[model samples]
Target: MISKRHADILKILDSSGTVTVAELANLLGVSTETVRRDLRPLVEDGAVHRMHGAVSLTGPTAEAPFRRRMRENAPAKQAIAARVAATILDGQTVMLDTGTTTSFIARALTGHRRLRVVTNSMDVARTLAVTGGNRVFLTAGEVRPDSGAALGPAAVAHVLQFRADVAVISAGGVDALAVTDYDPDEAEFARALLTCAPRRVVATDATKFGRRGLVAVVGFDGMDELVTDAAPPAVIASAMAAGGARLVLAG
Candidate 1:
């Protein structure tokens, strides 16, 4: 499903460099009532820039394009990416998921001499291809235009054929028992990916720390490690740790 918020954010960023509530409403074909509701959290989270009557991403008034939203918090995401990169050992068969955070890790891994990366994300695959010298494995299936990852039953079956040393996935949110995502196909595809990889690592930022998105990709008990920008809510973090999952705060 195409979320109105997602569609609006991406649309506004694409047409105008940055936009205000009024401008966004016009660009996104929505009402000011709906525009303000969508812009509130994005502005607060620093994902978008806001001003009296205009908004943009480059300057104080600019907002990040949807595709680059997660890259905005360089310090926090780099901290998280560093730890994720450190976890990769030479010659390990790793599974990388789609997300800005994971994409950062893919670029950070320049030192690893020998390793195979199996991923459904075109961006991650292309980024790693730049660093040079690693076996990059792309799964077989249809790509999802909405989420920027490979999906469909064929993709799930292809992932099941291999056992990864570690699978690093990005989440839209984290709840008590499950990982969350905006789209059901992406969530289901993620579930199948996790089942194929015995050791699972979740790569998410502080913004996704406690929210529950549309679907549960997997539960806390299913993870081997949870890597984030900050310490997750103590109670939830502890519960995850108790499940034998290591909870590491990068930022």
Candidate 2:
């Protein structure tokens, strides 16, 4: 489904055939950033082709980046973290992927002790380290400077060697029916973790609602549960259900 802003912009263009980002932003009383962001999904969806600062949707649609596309949805992220934390069993081995949403899980896990954490996330490992009283194993791999997470052939291999009771993976995007990521290595790492671990969970905010991008990380069919802020829209809810995921609505 097209975003409200995207739809509105498209409506205005039916009469003129095209509009610039600046004009759309000014007309909509929103930032150019917002306008550009709205256009990106259309470009990815092939609904509209973006030319310079302008966009036009003719047919179909492309995927949008979930994690990076929507960074400001803090409330949804926190709620998802709370739900993810609630799923942990005492002393259960858990693996968390590298993402801001997963970091919130680390914070929520502060009170838990003696839990085994297998992770490639420097921030997550550091958080557990300072918290004290946890059996955390840092994965051996190359760290991606931007995400501050370890990933590589070694990381994938290392993650695959372990078996955990639970694993929480995050992503950069999702479509009407698939889960995906923008970084190929991150996708590979997450998939490897899911493969080795038994019970799998996905943590994502609402902004990841409806889009697919880059590469497929894990299909919806693979997740045992999906922890999100609330019951998402009809499309998202249906997709997760179709995959047989126990949808956990947090907060």
In terms of lDDT, the best-performing candidate is 2
Model 2 alpha-carbon drift over 4 Å, by segment: 1-71
TM per model?
Answer: 0.72, 0.72
Model 1 gets an lDDT of 0.73
* Cα misplacement distance, residue 40 of candidate 1 (Å): 17
Q: Write model 1 residue lDDT over 17-133, tens digit each, in one string.
A: 534455566667778787777767666876666544445553344433445454456677788889888878888888887777787788777678677888888877887665547
Q: List per-prediction Cα lDDT, in the order shown.
A: 0.73, 0.75
Give the number of the best model, judged by TM-score.
1
Regions more than 4 Å wrong, model 1: 1-66, 130-132
